[model samples]
Target: MIYLNQAGYAPNSTKRATITGNNHYNLFSADGKKILSGECTLEFDENSGENAAVIDFSEVTEEGRYFFADEDNFRSPEFVISKNHYDQALRDSMKMFYFQRCGMELEEKYAGVYKRKACHCGGGYILGDRFQRRKMLGGWHDAGDYGRYVTAGAVALAHLLYGYEMFPGALTLNLNIPESGGSLPDILAECKYELDWILDMQDEDGGVHHKCTSASFCGFIMPDEDDLDMVITPVSSLATADFVAIMALASRIYHKFDEPYSNTLAAAARKSWTWLIKNPSFIFENPKEVTTGTYEDLCDADERFWAAAEMYRLDKNEDAMKVILGTMELHLSMHCLGWADVAGLGTLSIINSGTDFFGKDLYNRLVMKWLDEADRLKLISQSNAFGITLRPIEFTWGSNMVILMNAMILCVAHKLTGDDSYLKSAQYQLDYIFGRNAMDLSYVTGIGERAFKHPHLRPTAADNIDAPIPGFVSGGPNFRPCDEAANPDNMSDVPAMKRYADDVRSYSTNEITIYWNSPLVFVLGYMNSL
Candidate 1:
């Protein structure tokens, strides 16, 4: 399979690039006639091997259907060079969050092709402290498992909120969710659905429980069918901190749409923030009996930073702003936005929060710091064969989220600096994920000609349909293939970019998660605006 941008590209945008060892290639009309032929320039990287082929279709300004072809491979899927190549993709990606909703019936009227049974309705209990049973009804099922984890859900929801915050104009596409034509944007409405679930996960004292899951992973069955010992586990400072950040953010955004809900969220945010402040070092350890994704965070500094930064945004507490600023100074460097580490979220909230809480000069300094970091990643991406930012060392679990987050950083930088290079790099990152990389597969479901079909997601496994749910991005290539679904013979010695297997058993490379799909929605939304 040859990878092109599955969302297509604009005629005036950056030249399209793809990986191919072959020396000759052709651009074909939709009718299978060669319109242009050229000798390929083989760029090589010691780390990523031979760079992909680059195609400059910028001169083809006529808006019409086209594709790529070579002597060795079959014809590529038809793509269009129009002004709105990414609009529908942005819509579908946002709808994925709706498909992931738990404890709610996916009625056929709203969720057309992705409807399913209601699940996880029964509340749960603390594992060791089983006597402390709490009502845990809502939120998304994390990854392929039928579990709802606070830290993981917070990260996904925060990223989705960031997307909405940064690109509100672009994300206004109607997703036909249950609240489709409501006053709130469809993206926010979908997020609010999960946010409501998140609210339910919180205890009376505002220390959010770490996760709600069965003692062991459920069988590869539908969510409604998974009937194990569902229990809500212990609360932790990390979960509370992450919860505070998301709630504060939700409170701010939801205020314009639903003031009463917004007020409730704000109160919850304050309570969670207070809980974290009082118990700063209350780390979370998975109870012995439970064996789900622990999402354990040993250090709470990033979570603390994020929570305080968000609280500053909502209420502007002087002490919270001071602590957030100090935390920013201490950790000037940013890591990939993930469930465990959230310093980047703290940093982004500060940059976009519109409050010169640290003074104008300090805020300017912070923006410069962020743009500089993004520039560093851009340089690496620009130098790579496929123009992807991730290095071989970065291909750990959930690598797709890291790659998408890198693109998101580029998008944020573009918004801040008006640098075309940043936007161009982000586009290339999208291209890489969709099909332009070594694997020659679109990581998203039901998009490319050779898109991911078998994800580790339970609904996909249980559904009668042949394809997985559309627009759900898979956990891309991982160097350490550690899941039971991982086929050792196919992955043991492959290159970093080539390590992905489309097989359903390859959980490390094939599972779908909200965090992975969230940035995809953000990036697609941004690209549609472009």
Candidate 2:
């Protein structure tokens, strides 16, 4: 199996393909003519422990479709070299959010073969607040499960918005959502679909519910078949803080197009921030009755910092700035820019907000801090056999998101410093997802020829389609195998990078989520713009 970018490579760029096994390979143009100057090398892979054959086409700069063939395999997938490489991919990745919408019918025209009946229309409860049992309806389904989580949704939205905010007109494409070619950009329109539900999750007092979920995980059935009671879980600091950040961010974007709606978002954000101030220490724990996904975060200083950063950006609140700066000393110790730990979010908000609250020198330092981290990750990625940004420890659940987040940070670094290397590294990470790394499979469904067909998606399972829903990105290559369903694959004893199984039961590697797709959208849109 050979892995090359599905959308192809750019001319005069370093173009390479990975194949497993010890053998020489020859690059061939679409016309079956030898294309490369030198022989390929088969080296031991540190990431997968496989005899990784690397076919380098960096020196072959002609812009044309080509493939590799040798004794170890037949013909590899065809790839091209052109400037507009990721154009179609960018559109497909953005359209994926349309498939993840909850409480809505996926019409045949928009969803194509992935269309489904309306589901999860049942409203949610407020759990234990004064407005306990109050109605909250309509949000994105978290992962393959029929649940709506605030923390995950907030992180996803913030990244998507950041992508839009950072590169103007990047997400300007019409995604063919219900609001395509509307007054608002299609990205914000799709975001509004989720925001409406998020607003419903917020209480009158400004606190946001942690999640709206069923009593238990839904069976391997369609959304319409899942009849469990939908209930809103208790409010938590993580959820409210995330809410504050997303709402404030959304308010800023919507203000330009829809002033009235922007005011509503701003008011909700302010209200949530007030509630967070009073209950800053509140931690959310799932009730014993609820057996759904718990997006629990124990330490919420980062979450608070994220919310404060956004709040300060929106209103220039001195208190918010003080809180953000007070947390700055602890920010350097932060890890990945993942949904779980949003320390990077606060830092990014400060860097992009254009507020001199932290002073110019400090702001410049924060920018350097992020770029330095990207530089370190880039070095690590470049050394790996697969050339992925993920370290050994990052191969946990939702590892694909981790990789995409790395690309997001690298893109930010590129924007800050105008460094071509950072942008190129970012594009390389995106290439890995589109099928240019270990496993030789595109983590995104229905995109590349070798993409995953059996994602752990409810609609895909029930729709009985031969192919999974297009554009849904799987949680690729989980090194730490946790699911009993995935144990039969014998991946637990395998090397970290080689532990992935494409089985539908392998939720660790096969599950799809909005958060994962969100970062993909951000990176793809940014790359597409370039």
Clashes of each: 3, 0
Decoy 2 TM-score against native? 0.95
Reference-based lDDT, each prediction: 0.80, 0.80
Expressed as tens digits, the lDDT of each residue in 186-216 for candidate 2 is 9889889889989988878988878888878
Residue-level lDDT of model 1, residues 212-331, one tens digit each, is 889899888888887786788888888889889999999888888999999999999999888877786676788888888889878888888888888988887876876776776676
Candidate 1 versus truth, CA RMSD in Å, comes to 1.9
Clashing pairs in model 1? 3-435, 19-52, 485-505
Model 2 regions more than 4 Å off: 40-42, 71-73, 128-132, 331-335, 355-358
TM-score of each: 0.95, 0.95
- RMSD to truth, every model: 1.9, 2.1
lDDT at 278, model 1: 76
Q: Give the C-alpha miss distance for residue 338 in model 2, angstroms.
A: 2.0
In candidate 1, position 390 carries an lDDT of 82
